[model samples]
Target: MRFLGFCLSMLPIPVIQQAGLALDRHLGDKAFEAQLEELWSAISTANDLVSKVSTLEEAIQEIAKTIEASPTLEAKTSEFIASLGSNQKEFSVLTENQSYQELRSSIVHADISNFVAIGGSTNVIQNSTVNSERTHLHATDNSKNFVDGTTFQGSGGAVSMRKITTQGQISVQGSGIGFGGEGGIGFGGGSSISFGGNSNEVSGNCPSCNELLRMDKRELHKYIHVQCHKCKSTFPFKLPNA
Candidate 1:
């Protein structure tokens, strides 16, 4: 599989374009085309062959799965795979190799970018900001979620908020997973929700009194200068691990 990456990366620009054109002709489905465009883009710009190869290999596996869904595309898929290698022999090595097939099956497609995150932890999110972005947050696996000193527990728990202005803190712990975002905090065991921008918001609790402090949407994008009615305390909001 790596040898395939080396060959593909080292190919002349002309040959690479030829190969891309060949795949585009055969693997012309919209999905495959999008994947190919990304693959070629990565190949052309990749500075680290190791990382590039790793990423491309996963991409190839995904393309294979798409092809697998349409048995009629098998021949075209073969041709596309062949175009990746230098010759028929290399193509056979890629197609006939047991490890290569196993590698494809083993891929777990978890896409986490700055806009997304997933994990488990005993942690705190405090004194931070979650800017207006498309962010999804999840907390799972029987964990305790403490947002602004208010506890949200049990399964299927989620809080969706556009903006959060708080002088509060969030803590996640126990045998579960917790995902944090930029602006607000969510505590739960099985719920997942989108958090950010031009939507309704969930209020926070005062760190000193654990009283719900409703927020004003007008306060969005400003530094935290929240007042707690119960304890008469004022403080700022911080991001996870800040």
Candidate 2:
């Protein structure tokens, strides 16, 4: 029990101090110290029970029962700390699937220019920048069925564009995950420009192709050059400090 006391003493001083303060508020310093000592003894007993238990599940059940039966708040706190370690171990095991590992590896190795993962669990970009004439990005998950026994599972889509200036147009659409479930969009800085969907006609015409220029407010901020789909000719437009 001396070793157990030492281990408990080595825990974060602030946590123990906070607990002591709480106990002192109700039980006084002398009673709090006595309760803390008793808690260490309970922890030692629980450790011994864990060693004697046949299986991990049995040990957890027994430890939970012991914690529930504790008379002092200190003992209950010690039990809760022990439970945190067990929960962390269980979490590691739950995430250690071979398929998940493979999926993670594939995503890590993939050189994704325009990524669209549909109808499955997949990883998305954390941060990225795109500089191009026209950037058309779309990630749609329309699959009715899911893999790996996960019913009603939806696909995830993410794009991060920083200091992006598109010459022509940028169309981004991500729709339908699990039965009318919609995907989300997150943009930072000047990347918040929206290009396609509904078009509002601009005042000018294309210089090269002589076609009418049509765009939205978001597009007008990002695109300095416009392209005509009819003639496939690109033309530059003059904007104020843009």
Instruction: Provide the RMSD of all predictions against the true structure, rounded to 1 decimal.
Output: 21.6, 25.6
- For candidate 1, write residues 164-202 as lDDT tens digits: 222112222222334343333455333443332222223
Badly placed stretches (over 4 Å) of model 2 are 1-41, 46-48, 70-242
Candidate 1 Cα outliers beyond 4 Å, as residue runs? 1-198, 239-242
- Tally clashes: model 2: 0
Candidate 2 structure quality by residue, lDDT tens digits, 95-156:
11111110110111111122222332121221222221112322233211111211111123
Clash totals for all candidate models: 11, 0
Q: Indicate the residue-level lDDT of 129 in model 2.
A: 25
lDDT of 2: 0.33
- lDDT over C-alpha atoms for residue 236 of model 1: 83
Q: Candidate 2: which pairs clash?
A: none
